[model samples]
Target: MSAAHVPVLLAEVVDALQPRAGETIVDGTFGAGGYSRALLAAGSSIIAFDRDPGAAQFAQGLPADRFRLLERRFSELDAVTGPGAVDGVVLDIGVSSMQLDQAERGFSFMRDGPLDMRMAADGPTAADLVNAAEPAEIARILYVYGEERESRRIARAIARRREEQPFTRTLELAEFIEKTLGGRRGAKVHPATRSFQAIRIAVNEELAELEAGLVAAESALKVGGRLCVVTFHSLEDRIVKTFLAVRAGKTPGGSRHAPPVETTAAPSFQLSFNGARTASAAELAANPRARSAKLRAAVRADAPVWRAAA
Candidate 1:
């Protein structure tokens, strides 16, 4: 599999990592080995992980000594590798372009293909969720993940339609959503875009995986090790923001009525930078997916790990 993936925030990630020779870095998402390749070029050894088996085929010609690919999710990082052994950990959260571009993988609403949306391609599909989930559950998923305001209407339509016949194809569901929700003509994007995002996220438990993966990355990094994350949508971005803020002791808690107290335990990492960094204009023009991408990074503090305060 020739890598068609365009690694988002490539230059920024390399700059943030500042990999040195012989240091082991974990490319937590390792979609197309973009970050891994760059790290190798920078003289760092890499232990990359990708749950998608498809990426293994793409690893064919990669130098085995400098880079190693593991067919596993980033959430399993701690289980798969020794803790606090890596010098840096980079996670590009969310689905990859490889998955979206492959129509048979069924990630994009623009393409016509099967309804299977599993990132690993080995689990419950979007069709299963649409057909089996309660309308309220589906509505919540749409509202939270897709940020779809018309979630109720869409969920009701999906529930009603599935009674007639289960959705099997991408275009079939996309067309149904567009027809039910009424697509906006001349819009930059299709109306089914949000619904597709909602369904795929739900099917893969993407957010949950991200949360687990963040904690795993935190645990896996050595002192002063960098944890770099690039999130695409607001949902993923919010989680990354909150996780970093809490870990860096930047989350605000008190209101005017109550006096503020630092409720969190001693922070495990210090804020490497204030806020998320976005790609430059040049990168944005090249990869439209980088338009909404936000890169947030933090360095593991030398202080001992602090368990969450109860």
Candidate 2:
């Protein structure tokens, strides 16, 4: 299948990965097959995974001999392949541009459609959460996931409105939110942006999936194998940063009140770059969606995957 959206930080990810001939790489979030296509062209075999079943249609025309698409979440990577089997793994976190553009997906508040925002076909949709979740739970989701400031007020508004009539359409909910939040008041973005994002993330459990998927990648990569992650927002980026920092043994430990505690654990990975890389001005100008993109990469160490301290 052809790419419906351009992959952000493509060259940077490729440079970090350096996929070689005969090596196997995992495209853990194979939206539109952009990275998979590029890696395939570089002569590497790929095992690509995507939670969205709709993404499989885009898997067409790929090299069948070198490519295999798994219609499952990337969190299943370690389960699907034995430890240290793949040379590299890459995850592009958050909703894709194509998903956002498709009104039927309910990822965007710009267009009117059903309030379904599931990555995979089978799941409780955004509509289910908004209509059924408790107000406090809804507030927590908005606050924690979307970082929305007026989450409580928004949740209350939704609770009251859904009592009158359950939200079934995207624009219907978006307009109600706009009215509750004072009609955007000439804001740069739509009033329902945060609500949409929060609902979508909650529906898909995206943040949890990302955390699991990163650990899975750590387990799946062979020694010296690389991991490249492209995150669109701070929530996803923060998880990636913390995971790598702790795994690389770069995180500062011990409190000012206590002496340093030592551990025998070995570093699982080494940072490939000093910090996350952002999109180039040229690329951002060409594709506005690439503006929020950030890329971070690392090389795996020979040490076994670290488990949480008991």
In terms of TM-score, the best-performing candidate is 2
- lDDT for position 275 in model 1: 85
Clashing pairs in 1: none
RMSD of each: 2.9, 3.0
Q: What TM-score should be assigned to candidate 2?
A: 0.95
lDDT for predicted candidate 2 compared with the true structure: 0.89
lDDT of 1 by residue, 217-296 (tens): 88788999999999998889878887778778776564442234465477888877888899899887777778999999
lDDT of 1 at 195: 84
lDDT of 2 by residue, 1-310 (tens): 4333669888889999999999999999998989998999999999999988888888888889999999998999988988899999999999998898899999889998899999899989899999999999999999888889999999999999999999999999999888998986779998888888999999999998998899899889999999999999888887788778778887746344223444567899999988899888888788788888999999999897886431
Residue 72 local lDDT, model 1: 87
Off by over 4 Å in 1: 1-4, 253-264, 308-310
Model 2 CA lDDT for position 8 = 85
Report lDDT (CA) for all predictions. 0.85, 0.89
What TM-score does candidate 1 reach? 0.93
